[model samples]
Target: MGIKNRLTVMSFLQFFVWGAWLITVGNYWFGTKGWSGAEFGAVFSTLGIASIIMPALTGIIADRWINAEKLYGILHILSGLAIFYIPQVDNPTLFYWVIFLAMMFYMPTISLSNSVAYNILKNNNFDVVKVFPPIRVWGTIGFIAAMWMTNLSGNKASVNMFYISGFASLVLGIYSFTLPKCPAQKSVVKNASWTEKLGLDAFKLFGTYKMALFFIFSMFLGGALQLTNMYGDTYLSDFANTPKYADSFVSKYSTIIMSISQISETLFILAIPFFLKRFGIKQVMLISMLAWVLRFGLFAYGNPGDGLWMIIMSCVVYGMAFDFFNISGSLFIETTTDFRIRSSAQGLFMMMSNGFGAFFGGIFSGIVIDKFFTHDGVRDWHNIWLSFAGYALIIAIAFAVLFKHKHYAEDVATVTH
Candidate 1:
């Protein structure tokens, strides 16, 4: 296989492991397991916790010691094993710990995969901005395929979805060792603080003006990102509560409907290079923030009947809402930072966005939903979605006002060669 093709396989399996369970797990948790909303929120918080603690640490390991590809393989193997053991846990609290452990192993691999792909692509004289997205789109396809597999096979709410995730993860873990080497870049640690010595200097990104604002907004948008993942599928399925929609195709196939978001991702992922090159990262991201507003607003008013298009439209908008920030943000970090700290920098981005963003988003959203949205054992999902839409809008306006980055063609040109 070509190097890009090889990286593409890695990307495909990388997210496939995540997709098999991520969107559907809410269904499994709330529907099959009958867990409380508050507890389920804690369950999602595991993603944030592990992301906060592990990514930068693992990036440091990859930066200073192990090969990025090797480190990635080891982590995936661990994630596979840990996730495979999840079906055996009976208590929600124990389930939380187990998921936390699995995520600690799993989450770091996400950033590591980007690092490995970037390393291999750059080494082979590929233009990263032009080349990476096409390969990355396969990751979304892998995610879509996995979701369909789980849903079509009647496994969306079953323990088997985890099995599906675990098995793909293990295979990818084994496959990773064969990829091109991405060696530790820092030759020596010297003349620096403890954070620098420990390869944590990426944390210093917050000290700068533009990057600080950028990351802050990224964190806020990251919160919006999970709002859908945590509830999109569950929301569609919940229409069953309305007798008129009880036997509707949506309730029967909510997972499939939700997969449209990932499918939308494929096209949007391809468009990112054009968007980034034309509009620059700041405007592109601002557009993404606005898309999030539409994403939630549509969902707030969407239903299984006449409003079905609104629901479908929400999923469509999800494509731009998701890809604009994540891919562009990572690429922006790639072009601007010192290459020695590449992996660490990516980890830091993940920390701010997925770490702090996800942690607080999960915990607080759950509490708010339980306290305000849930009434008499039923959730007011319509208002719940509108509240989320309002939050995204606030962030969009703030980002437009405060964050500043002029799009010079040369800014992105750094990696284009």
Candidate 2:
């Protein structure tokens, strides 16, 4: 196979491992295991805890010591082993630790995969900017395929989903070893400061008003990011409790229905360049925040019956809510930061959005749901979604008021193209 095809397969399996279990894990937790929301929230927070330091640490190892591909392969294998062990544990606290270890192995590979791909592409004389996106899109397709596999095989809420993910992860881990080598770069400056050497210079951006506000909001919005991922499938599957909707398509195929969100993500990615050029970063991001409000509000009122449209629309809106802020925020950081600190700044962006953001979102939302949304062990999804919508709305209004960006059409046009 060609290098691009190899990378495409790698990308596909990378997300497939995640997609198999991510959306449906809630079903296994709430539906199969009958876990408490607060404990489950801690479960999701493992991603946040791992993201806080693992990616950067692994990046350093890949940069200085090991080949990126080798590191990536090893991580996946370890993560797969951890995931395979998940079904054996019945304790929620032990489950959290196991998943945390799995995340620690898995999360860093996300960035490492890109590093390996970019290194191979550049070495092979390909135009990375032009070629990478097309290959990366396959990852989304892989995710959708996994979701379908989980739902259709009657394993959406079963331990089998973990087996599917674990086996795929192991396969990908082994396949990664055959990919082109991405050796570490040993070009570090001898006179570099400790902060620079450690990739901690990005933290200094917190000293500036604009960047401080941006990172703060990134964390706040990041909290909103996984709310749906943590609960959407569970919410849809819960509809089975209703006699009329028990056999309905939406309830029966909740994972597939939720896959529409990933599909929408691919479409919205295509729209970003146009949206950025026309609306500027701030406006585009504001549009994303508003889209989040609608995303949740629609879910609040949606069901598998006549209200199915609202559910589907919510999935459609997710494209904008997710892509706009994430992609646009990266662009904003890229265009604005100093050349020397550019890479670190981007890492900082991910740290805020995925690290602190995921942590806050996972932990608090779980507690809040358990405390306020649960009644007699049943969840009030309507009020739950409404509360989430209200949270996003507040973030939008605050962003509109506090984020001071003067959007010049010429500036955006120049930067985008």
> Which runs in model 1 stand beyond 4 Å of their true positions?
189-193
Error of 1 at 377 (Å): 1.5
- Poorest 10 consecutive residues of model 1 by lDDT? 185-194
lDDT tens digits by residue: candidate 1, 100-120: 999999999988999999999
Please name the candidate that would achieve the greatest lDDT relative to the true structure: 1
Model 2 TM-score on a 0 to 1 scale: 0.90
Highest TM-score model number: 1
Candidate 1 residue 229 C-alpha distance from true site, Å: 0.9
